[model samples]
Structure formats: C-alpha cells, structure tokens
Target: MTASWPPAPLSVDEPVGAPTLLPARAYVRAEVLAWERRHLFAGTWSCVGRVDELPAQHGVTVGDVPVLLTRDGDRTAAFANTCRHRGHELLPDGGSADGRVVVCPYHAWVYTLDGALRAAPRFRDVPGFSAADHGLVPLPVEVWHGWVFVNATGDAAPFTVHLGELAGLVAPYAPEKLKLAARHDYRVRANWKVIVENYQECYHCPRIHPELCAVSPPNSGHNYDLPGAWVGGAMDLREGAETMSLDGRSRGAFLPGVDRRRVLYLALFPDLLLSLHPDYVMTHRLRPLAPDTTRVECSWYVAEGVLDASYAERFWDRTNRQDWAACESVQRGLASPHFRPGPFAPNEDAVQRWVTLIRRAYLGTPPWEGQ
Candidate 1:
C-alpha cells in the first residue's frame, strides 16, 4: 500500500485539549503488529547498518524480512537471504565473512558476492534445472551519508525524496566524513512506537533526564514539521554549555561547521532517530522483535582518528537508560485494560506529527478521523 505523503490535516472537531493517543491495542496486539510488518515496515526505507559494517558480507532483517548485504568490488548489493531450493536462511543474522562465496548451510548452494547462483550440490540431475533462473532476488538498497538503508518491497521512492528537507538541515555536519566511534545495543521491553514517541518529545526530560535538562532546557526549543517522513527541530543549549556531555563540555572537536549553541533532534519515522550535536552525531536504529519488545542499536560518529569518546558515550548511556525505563513503564501500563488514549501536551507536537504519519501508513487514515 502506498502511503499518503504529508498526511491530510486533522479534523477541526477533533479535541486537542485531550487529544487521544493511538489506542492501547496498537502497542500490544499481535494482529496490529503484523499489519504494520506487512504495510509500514515493508513499504518504507528502513536503515539497516553502516556502510563499513558490511565491507565484506552481512545478513540483517529489515523488519521481518531477512536480507543480505555484500560488497562486490566497489559496490554493495542486497538480496533476499533465503535460498531458492527450500527457503532456508542463507546467512546467519548480523552477518559473517566466509570469503567471496555465500554457501547455504542447509544444501550448500553457493552464490557469488553479486548474488549469482554459482553452484548447487548435485542439482544438475533434476530435469530442466537452471541455475540462471534461480539467482537470489534483489532488494533496493541506498547508501546515504555512510549509512545503508534498504526497502523490502523495492518499490518505494528514492531515499532522498523520502528524507525531504532533512538532508539540507543536516548538511553542515558532513555526515559522510564522520567515522564510527562507538556502538551500543539495547533490547528494551517496550513497543517500537513507544520508544519513538518518547524520543520525539521532551515532556519528560526535566523529570527523567536531569543532566540533559541541565545542559539543554526542556522548554527551550521549538518543533519543526518537515515535509515527507521527518519531524524535528533545534534546541538551544545553556549559556555556557558546549555540548550535551555529562559536564556540559565538548568531548571532541566541533563537527566541521556546526553551531555550538544549539543541537538538533530528528525522528525519521518507522525506524531512525538522529541527535546532531556540534561535536558528534548519534543515531538510533530501532527494530521490532515483538509487539512489546524492540532492539535498539545506538551508534556515535565523529571526525576520523578521534579515539576518546568516553564523555559522550557515558552521558548518552545514562540518558538512554532513562528513556528506555520510561518507555518500559508506558508499555506495561498500555497492556492494562483500563488504559485508554490520553491527551498530548503542547510540548508533544512532534509526537503528534509522528503518530499522524504512522497512522496514515498503517490504517490509511489520520489519527483524528480514527478517534
């Protein structure tokens, strides 16, 4: 199903004073998650990993569909990870390097890095068998600013088009020139949407994130509603604050041309979250494991050869744990039969936009109409 871009405006009669959140079932129902897996995840551009992570070969799941990334010479290619013979998974999840050929563990079907069927054990004996007709199915993959994003349906619009003006907003950081500095993964007991909603708004910042609020006031920012699938804005840092580290000081050199007084936060719907600071960029890629569980991979990037990242890492680790704890609490409450849709605060405009876009993608209706 094609998503309706720039979701239609909400109904005027829809109550904003106590604007209802997406129904509780949306967070804990198995059928609802399956619908999202088929429509939302399958049809959008979801980031998988960094370009450097797949220098050889890597296997990953975009939503629920397993895919493989291989570097063929100077180019990277993506294909369905299932072998054609019997639908067995070709490579293990998270990737591995066993040379140029990908050999299926079940039947030993060998495929070249470019996804060509190289050989199959005793397959020629079958009548009218042709390896040429059974090469791995290709998926659409685009590498933008050193990150790799893949679309399972292979029919979505170009990645840049989906990104809209976000590309220009973050151009000053020169993301392509930044190198990976540290990576951390967390498995949170929360729905993927819960995590996203928590990140999009800072309503809970002052109460939950003391250090973050000290450096960047929770009430000192405005939200921007960008076209396409992104929503974000810049938040001003405290008077003497250089960055969002534990001590309000920058841990490394400023990213080429970034402004030191403000930091940018963006929520790229369905999967990616970005935190752009003067000295570094932090990315969070969320993968849904179940209706109530998600796997979040957080990575930090900075100018090449800068090795000391403890300051930034420690601060974010503490902040992320706080966010995750809040999300988990919300998830538990959502499962209760008494839990109903609640009002959104004025500070949660970005969260409203996120909910609108996701509702459009999943139910083909705006949140107000559904309510």
Candidate 2:
C-alpha cells in the first residue's frame, strides 16, 4: 500500500521541474512486459470486476494471474482459478461457472462456490491424493465502493491500507449506493503506460480536446501527491458549465454529498482510473494484453433515482477516443529507432510521480527500498 501520491491541490501559478520519461524499450519490448506481469502485476491489488457484475462463481484474470470470485454463503470470496486435479483451469479465461459450483472441463472435478473441493470422480485409489489437500488456493479479496479487487500474491496490505486517507476524500460520493449505468470496453493498440500518461497530463487538452476545454480548462486543475498508492486532483468547471456533457449540462440528479463545481480524476496504481463528477463516478479498469496492447473497461455509476447518462456517455466516448488516438500514436512513435525518451512537462508532475512508481515496480523495487 506504500505509494507516492498527493491528497490536496497545490496552488501554483507556474509549472515547474521537468523529469525525463521512461525509455522506449519499456514500451515496445516483450521482455519488459514479461517482467511486469510477474514482478509488478502479480503482487499488486488489481481490480477484476464489480460486485454486482460478478456471478455466483466468476472467473477473471488479475494481470497475468487467473482468479475466481464467488459467493461463499453470505460473504464474497476469492481463490486461484486452477484446480488441484491435474492442474486444470476452472474457468479458462473470464466466464461464470454453473450455478454455485465450478466444474473443470478437463476432468469433472467439482468445487463449491467457496473453492472447497467437493468431488473428484474416479480418483478414489490414487495414493496420497486427498480432496482435503486439493482445494483451490485462496487469495486476498476486498470489495470497496462496489468494485471487487483481488491480490494475486495474497500478501499485499489490506484494501483499507491501500486507500488510507484517500477513502475519506471519496466518501462524499456515497459510491456504495451508486449503480453501474453505462459501460464501454476498449481495446487500445498502445502500451497501458501510454494511456495512463495521457490521463495524468492535460497539457495537450487545448489542442485536441476542444469540447472538454469548453467545459473545463485543461490547465485549471491541481494535482495531488498524497500519502497513498494513488494520485489525483480536481479541475474546476467553467462558470457556465454544469457538467462534462456536449452542452456542459448535467444529465441526471446530483450525487448525495457532491455539491461541487469540479471533477475529480485519479489513478490507483497498476490499473484503476477514477473520475468523480457531481452526478456520477467513472472508472477505467486496465488489463495489459501485450507489450503494445491493452484492454480497458470503462464504467459509469449514477445515483439511485438518476437513470440515464446518454449525454455523459457521448461526451466521454468522444473524449476517450481522442485520448486513445494520442496514446496509440505515441505507441507507434516509440517504435522509431531515433525516438528518444522526452522530458515530462512542468505541469506533468502527477505523470512523473506515477511513472516513477511504475518504473520502480517494473524494475522489481519495492516502493520504500530506493527512496
């Protein structure tokens, strides 16, 4: 849970300090991606899906690790997706099991929803093969604000520690009461870091994002470098703008305690992009597919009575495409042998800090070891 982040905004009139970016090989090399899958993604808390979206016996991939989420009695639970009988995958990729039990396709090994071994057909005579010792391996899981997250390594700090004081800042939205109203899954032909960097810095907003600029100034926000594993800040909305829609007007009723004129954007390391607005909350969950490809699941949650978010969806769909285009261009650009890593802009402090954290992880360095 240790991270380099900020909680509040710094009121600075001028941008300061430019840091060098990561090398090109980090983006285009398969070896780097392999290192990240093992060292970085394996140990971190990665979100798989939402509580409501999960089935009775759900299977998902957390980074490179396959995990299972299920309802054990009344509480939700997580376990390794591998079966003990000859090491068969319970759900293969990402899908739901039959009813409340997992039936391995290779062999008819049955496991209950909570990962308890139920039956191993035709294996009664196998020596030293006990069903008790073959239950699915358990993993640490936490359901925070309706999002279901699992730790692949089973040893990271609790999700509470991961949130720290940042939890208090997000409490005003009453996220647990919100419901998923819209979702968009994307496949971007770019490294995940490239997409993350685009989210962190708005220095390019003036040129590519005219609609966003009309609602909120690109450089009119403050960045947080708080005491948790996340970095975020808010940009005040334009005086005439009500929300991030085509017309800058709200699409639904305001959230419970979010009577504000700004929008919150932050990233929980590894892969969670959170944006809090007056009427709803939007989240982007990332999964790296290759060295140069990533899968993004973007979802928006609205308050109980507020149903539709068509306008909001349209606005972000356009904005998201623009951002993805930029990221894809950067990915293609990184393939050039002449392209050298550039220095981060003075306004990209958040990106620099977050990138530093990622670099440390990709290099297999613990957050507290080097600093």
Candidate 3:
C-alpha cells in the first residue's frame, strides 16, 4: 500500500538565509520560564483539564501551581488555588462536595467559589487588613466544548478571539462529540520542542511507523494541513490498506458527519496533542518538567455509548509506543555535536510557522526577519 500524498522536503543548505540551530541546552534556563509565562502562558490559552473533571469534587494541579476550577451558578470560575493570608496553598488534591468556599488548611482563611474572601479563622485579632482585602487570586479561564482552558496571567486576549482564524480550522473535527478515552503519561529526556517538532512533521513517519504508514497510504506524503497547532492530512482508506490495529474502525465511523476522510491531528498550543481516526481519538499533553525533560500525557476519546474496550486500547497503544520510541531516539540524537540546524522544507512550513509564532512571542522576531 502506497500513500497518495505529496512530498515535502526541507532544504539542507548551510550558512544561507535560513534558521540557525539553537543550542540544545537553552531550553532549560530559568529565563525561559519567565519568557513562557509572559509570552506563552500569559497571552495564550492553556488546556487545564477535561470539562467533566472541573466539578467541585476534584482539583488538579498544573505542575506545582495549584488551581481550582468550579462552576458557579451558571458560569465557571478559576482561582490561583492559594490562600490570601499566610500565602498557603489551597485545595491540596480534592475539595468538598459543595466546594462553595475554599478554606486554607493552615489558617482557615475562607474564600467563596468565585475567589472572594468570605471569612477568616480568627479575624478579630488582626488589624488594618479586612476580609474584603483578602481573596484568592483569579486566573483567566475559558471553556470550549467541554475542554477547560486557563490563562495564568491576569491580562490576555479573550480566548475566543485570540485563536483568530485558526479556530475555524478545527471546526470540522466536531469537538463536541469527542469523549475522554485513555490517558498515558510519559517522562521524556529531551526538550519540549523536540517532542512538538516530532509531531509537527511526518518526515520520520515512513522510517519509524511502518504499521501506521501501511494503514494510512498518505502517511509518507508529509503534506499536512496546518490549522494552527492541529494537523490534517489525507489517509487512503482506499481498498486493501492494512490498519494500525485489527479492532479499530475506519475514520468515517468515528466522526459520523464526515465522508471518507481518515486522518487528523490537533495540538493545543504550548502542550496538548490530539488526533482522530474513525474508531477513536487519542490526545496527548506534553508538560515541561525541566528544560531538558518533559512529562507527556496521552488520552483516548471515543464516540459516546460505543464500547469495545480492546478496539481503543490496541490501536492507541501501538501508535503511541511507536511515537514515543521515535521521539526518545530523536532526543538522544539531539545531543550529537554533528546535529546542525537545516533548512525548512515546503511541507514543513507548518512546523516553521509554529516555531516562528512561538519565537516571535518569545524573542519578538520571525525566522526570516533578519535574513
């Protein structure tokens, strides 16, 4: 089985008008954290958790920063998950059923669901400061189709509009039907960019994913449609194409509204990667544990009411294992002294665009601005 996709190869010329290779070690600097907060985390929306997980009963922390997301009346609100007085962290892991008020474990400072200070353990003894002055810091949060997103910075472009035209790119994926399937966490020994770069291009697919390439005839083309962080590429459900797994269904089966289309991948900026086939969708989140190391979490989603346990597991397990194997191996190669920055292929323009957008946000310069 061969792919009907177009070939996209990058230029290999050196010392010309092209991107220079960045040092492999620069990803771990403390300065990068500040840059991420300001450039990446500040202005952009971040995937916090699944919409079902945001109820009052459960509280999840993103890294060491604890945050509380709960529904209030008809709306959802977010707080820094920290207490105002004594600066204690609130909501260790889980919260009460009501989650109406957050009480600091250390001093019993209480805050309303919306982060307003409601009471104190013993405020009568304190002077000058009042309950009104103490409240949980609010973090900007947004929800789209059951997915929860939060912006740590107080100031950011509205979530809906910040996405710009890119939102339209994913409109066809029917995000509303996407259901949580399976989640896998990975600790990788490479920069976060290494993992993202790996996902952004199919240049390595033919060499690393023989099973996937066999199933999706277009896997070798590397011609992907870049709708922001999401990638859409055609797959041949054409006759006789072997599948990644025997239990899996075709792409039309997963997304009922679509036609013969079979392949799609979407990455929620900074850290989330999600893809869909006919039977199920597998999503992954890559968290930067260190400059040189990252923790990756992948989840599978399927159509509601459809349960074939083995169907979802077999396909994702095989594909994910192959993906990680390739990424980890690439991480090892990045340490090589001979690994130089090469030119971008027309097919890889999406990766370059993603990198350009991120670098512009971080360094205030585009890849070809100086060239």
Candidate 4:
C-alpha cells in the first residue's frame, strides 16, 4: 500500500539558523567521558541485549560497570556483578551459569538466579555477617518488546515511561514478536556521542551514503522532535523501491501488521538505536568504552521463521561501516586545536535536540550556556 511522503508531522518548528555543534572538548576530554558515565549512562535506561541472551544467568559491562543478568522463573533480574564479600567479579563477561546459582570463580560464593545470597563458603562463621544483608545489590531491570534494559543507578523513570510514545509509534511493527536473525559488533574509534550525533541527522547522506541516497533521498524526509528519549520520524522510499536493501527489493513479507512505504528510525538516547522497516528491524546498542572509543553491537530482527536476511543485513552492514568511518574521522578532526564547532543545517534539528538532551543530562543545562 502507498503511504504519504512524510508519515508524521515535523516536531521541529519554523526554520532557524543552524545552531553550533558541541565543543571539541565534549568529544576528547577524559573528564567529559567520566561525567557522562556517571550522569548520562548510569542514570538512564540502557538496552542491554535480548532477554533470550540470558536464559539462566549472564554477565555484561555497562559503561565499565560489570552487571549480571539472570532469568528467574518468569522474571529477569539485574545486579552488580561484583561479589559482596571481597568485590571480586562473580562471572566473566558474557559467561553463563549452568544451573540456578551463580558461583563466584574467585571464592565460590554462591547466589541464586534471583540475586539473593544463597551461600558463602565460610561467611556463616562470622559473628555479625548476614547473608540476608549481603545479597547481590539489585539494579532495575525490565523487558520491553523482548529486549532487556537495565538502569545502573536504579533511579531513572520506568522503562515504559522513558520510552513515552515510542512504544505506540513502533507498535505496528510488532517488535515483540520478532526474532533475532543476525548480529554484528564493531569497535568504533569515536566518542559515543559523536556516533549518536551522526545517526541523528542525514544531511551527510548525499556525500557519504550513495547507495542509501539512491533508495531514500537524503532530502526526502523530515525529523520529529518526539517527547521522551526517542527522536525520529519516517522517511519515504523511492517509487517502486520495496525495502532498503542493496537491490531495493523485498526479501520477505511486510511485518505482520505494518504495510507502509516509509522506514522509521529512532535513536533512544544514551544507548539504543532502532530502525524499523516494513520487513525487518535493525538495532544498534552502543557501549561507551573511552573518551575516543565506543563499542557498537548491531542486531537484525525479522518475523519468526524468515530464514533469508542477507539482503537487509548486507545493505546495513555496508551502511553502518560507512557511518562508523565518518564518525571516527570526525573524532580525529575534533581533536585538532583549530577545530571549532560548526553550524547545524536546518535538516539537522534532530542533532541539535540530541546535543541539548546530552547537555541537560550531564550539565543540567543547554549547550549554549557554557555547559
């Protein structure tokens, strides 16, 4: 079925001169990265991975803080990966527990799948040591549309609350029923915010993404300043183009209930990037590793039972590499002493909004106010 060119109203108001990009220090300063680790990443709801990844128990690192994820009965739990006894890590990165209890490799301290302290080798002999008080420190964990999310500080708004209207905007895709098709990981030599800002705007599409611009013109869409953590909108595909594949063809049926001629892309602040197409969904989970380095994990999801995902995967794999290369170059440029903030194009309203959000989160003010 044919759809309108701009699927939704533009959230940004009348045209204004491009605002300046974030200062170079925001990308290269060690203190800036540390501030983000505490204020932005620690206090936000970050998409960790698919709930299926941790069938029993698994360990991961979020913004350098080791975390343990476990599936307990029908509920999922997240906790500090360190053992309370001696601060030793309980499980190795991505390591899984065989049964219900996760045992620390260092001292054999054991904890149940639900994060409750079950046993400590010799702690019972202590006069005042209490297993009840020494259970794994729990962090907030929630599952949305099959993806697991955790808040390191356990003080952010609920997952649904932070998502706001994004849940309804993507409801047509039925992401809840989609199954993981493939995954790829990349080590990008760029700041996490640089990567995020790049994804927030497509003004560079004509210069950097020839194949993408061929299927979806760089100037053919508008951005939405949606409420909550997400900022995105739909972009129309070229006439007769069925999907955003290398051949501009459809590899499978449209997602169960979504029949549209436009693709939706949303950057859920701090970590998750969601791209919704008629036939499949692509997500990028960003992990900030250092001031000038980031780890990106990308995954493709399609309706259950669809075997062939080569077209979409290859297309995006190429597109993602191009984006990462550009981001790394920008990171290098920002380090130059002569590099100064540049103006944002009218089409880059989303990037401006993203910068504003980051400033608000980290400095408690807008970027222009010297934050």
Q: Write the per-residue lDDT of candidate 3 for residues 7-124, one digit (tens) a residue.
A: 1122222365876434444444555644454445433566776776566634545544566776766578877777788777676654535667667789887777777888887676
**Model 4, C-alpha of 201: deviation from truth (Å):** 1.5
For candidate 1, write residues 170-198 as lDDT tens digits.
78888889888889999999999999999
- Which stretches of candidate 2 lie above 4 Å from their native place? 1-18, 125-129, 367-371
Clashes of each: 0, 5, 9, 0
Q: Which portions of model 1 miss their true places by more than 4 Å?
A: 1-18, 123-128, 365-371
TM-score, one value per model: 0.91, 0.91, 0.81, 0.90
| lDDT by residue for model 4 (131-242), tens | 8998999998888888888887766767766787778878888787988888999999999989889987888999989989888878777777555776777788999899
* lDDT tens digits, residue span 1-371, model 2: 43222221211122245556777888888877775665456566787778877778877877678887887555889998888878877886678864877888898999887778999998888888888888889988888888877888776666766665668778899787988889999999999989988999899999899999999989897987566667778888999888889899987888866856999888876788999999888999898999899999998888888778888899999999999999999999999999966777888888887778766555445432321
Best by lDDT: 1
lDDT of 4 at 186: 98
Q: Model 2 scores what on Cα lDDT? A: 0.80
lDDT for 112 in candidate 3 is: 75
Candidate 3 RMSD computed on C-alpha atoms after optimal superposition onto the true structure: 7.5
The residue ranges of model 4 lying beyond 4 angstroms of the native Cα positions read: 1-18, 365-371
Supply the TM-score for candidate 3: 0.81
